[model samples]
Target: MYCNHCGANQPDHAVFCSQCGAKLQTQSESTVPSEQEIDKEQTPVDYLDQLRSDQSSNHTDSEPTLPIANKPIHRAEPASSTVSVPPSGSPPYRSTSPARHLTWIIPTVLLLGIAGTLFWWYQHQQDINVQVTQLHQEASQLALKGQYEPALAKITQATTLRPTYAVLTKDQTMIETANRIHTKLETVSSNLKQNQLQPAEKSLITLQKALDTRKESIFEQEKTLANRNQDLLAVLKVKKELDQLDTIDALAYKLDEVDRLNNQEAKEVHQLIINKIITISMKNAEKLLQQNDFSQATAAVKAGLQYSSKDEKLLSLQKRITSEKEAFELAEKQRIERAIQQAEEEDLKNRTAGVELLNVDTQLNEYGDIEIYGEVKNVATKPIYSITVYYSGYDAAGNYLFSSSASVEPYDLEPGATGSYSAYEYDWYEEVTVQIDNITWYLE
Candidate 1:
């Protein structure tokens, strides 16, 4: 048969074209069927014989025919159809072959990859930890060297890099220890700077003791850090006090330091005091000189000069005192001499006056033999004069001996004053008196 679509020749019994794979239509045969058509309706064995006969007959034709009846068809079969039907008791079909059973390999590979990654991470972490530890160690060393700021920076970096590293514990401890040592050193340094050696030394000792205790503790590093802070605080306090000190206070502090150090500077401090004292003394002396209390002022100047012997003020004061004392002595001597001369003149005046008599004798007979005498003299122009005479005599103790009187009227006297009167002599001392005008002279 010819296919109308492509004009390809096909067998008469073909339902489709072999080359183009197109469908063909069959025409109906009338009345008696053709022998080929009758043969197609045979039993299974007769059909097979027919196919063999057709194949043998078609071999002589020149046209290419479908070799469907000559060779067995080897078309690919479906997996389900090719599967062997196992006996009822046998195990079911397994698609996986023994050689293809690699279920364990994927999980094993994954686990190995995970392990490798974990190992790499662990090694990296270990390197980081080592670096952190080294950094911490360096910080500790800096702290030991009293480089607090730098050490703190290094420790801070170390902590940041490996905050929980196992090796960091020891490093942290060392860092803390270094901090404590730094603090103690700082306290000592501050004390020295402030000139408060005693207190500073005490604080330093306390810090050292604390450090010793901290060293025994598990958290020694932390303790050391605390101690360092304390030291800083102490130093800061001292610095503040020092800053506030004025000139006088600073000088006093220096003097105290000199005393503490037993240094030669002590002499300088003492000299300053001496100068001040001398100045004050001189000022006081000047005031005294103003008040004209030269004695006291001179003494003050002398005392002041003991401290400063060559002081001009003191020398001036001494000169003033010497001048004043000489003037005073001269005046005093002149006054004493005037007083003595006046006294002597008065004595001479008293001696030049004549003595006056109180009474003249009157009675005579009752006593034994006696002698009486009297004389008068003019005190003004004449040297000698004559006047009434009176006499009296008595025994050793004034017992009446003899008495007599003689009146010489209108007696004459010389120019210079002279007078003589005699009393009667008795056994012993006797009283005698003369009355001239109203005046009386006594002779004894």
Candidate 2:
């Protein structure tokens, strides 16, 4: 008997091959034979060759045949052929069959192939995990920097690496919200700087609402900054209102408002206001000073100093105004004195113009008074209504002794008419000389 699969020789009673472990075909289920039934004289036949002889004997030209791993000894296409038989009593041909080797090799190859595939799958999964984790870290870093758009991009790209990862969707939503808030915050800051109070206020309100809805602790700092900027926006609103006022009162009121603000931006704006006040004050006061308006100029300097009391330019301007005022007063006083003196000299010339002194004599009278007599004639075309004589008496040494004035006897002297004039001085002089000094009259 033989094994049908590997063609191994076996004992006559053996029901299975010893070499290939293939089951042997037997007449019936039976026990192993005794030594009397052992066919030691009989030779074994190769089961593979016997299978081919049977296949050839049953071969038909029209019947389809299946191929085994190894080619069969007979072609199914040939319908008839003489079956070849090995010589009797020669030890039955024993050879290793390809099926015998393939029995274990196929299973080993399938196992190795399965192990390699699993190892490759595991390594690929590890790489995807590392890449996804790296993307998550980069996205987190970008988010911390307020780079919300880039963070979103990085996290969204992580979805490409691991599309089934549901965590990335949540991260996308978070970064999107942060990006919107960041944009609004920037808008608020820009509006504040440009003095757009309404827009900035609106943006702040929106930001506050968003933060409140989220109630996220991460946005705490942004909320704090928004609140702080809101205060500045209020101050800027006041400043804007103040800027529209053209009156002196409004400007002064703005100076008063400066004390109320405590923010750094507000302080900066307040400083600008102070500078504007000083600049405007200096210009106004300087113009007034040029016009010699000392009172108004002083008021202008005071208006500037009311806000910034220690400003150097204002202080210097105040001193300049004071000095200018003093100099102006002194100059005014001298001018008035000179004007009065000129008026007096002009009046004197007008009064003495038409009077002519014909003769002037002085004598010591018995009463011890010095007497001066002068004859005055009208020298102009108009008549003098009343005549008066003025005299200056001189001593022999030519020094002035006294002045005497007296009305002439004929009060209504016609023009070109002679009139007698006399005047007496209480003191007497020896060898006196008198001259008519001036005559005063009203024109008729």
| TM-score of decoy 1 | 0.27
lDDT per residue for candidate 1 within 272-384, as digits (tens), equals 54455466666776788677677887787677676567867667767877787678679878988987886566444323432334224422334642444444444432232
TM-score of 2: 0.44
Runs of candidate 2 exceeding 4 Å displacement:
1-101, 186-196, 212-235, 244-268, 276-310, 321-444
lDDT of 2 at 148: 73
Against the true structure, what is each candidate's TM-score?
0.27, 0.44
Among the numbered candidates, top lDDT falls to 2
User: Number of clashes in every candidate structure?
Assistant: 21, 0
- What local lDDT score does residue 242 receive in model 2, on the 0 to 100 scale? 60
Lowest summed-lDDT stretch of 10 residues in model 2? Answer: 27-36
Q: What's every prediction's RMSD, in angstroms? A: 24.7, 14.6
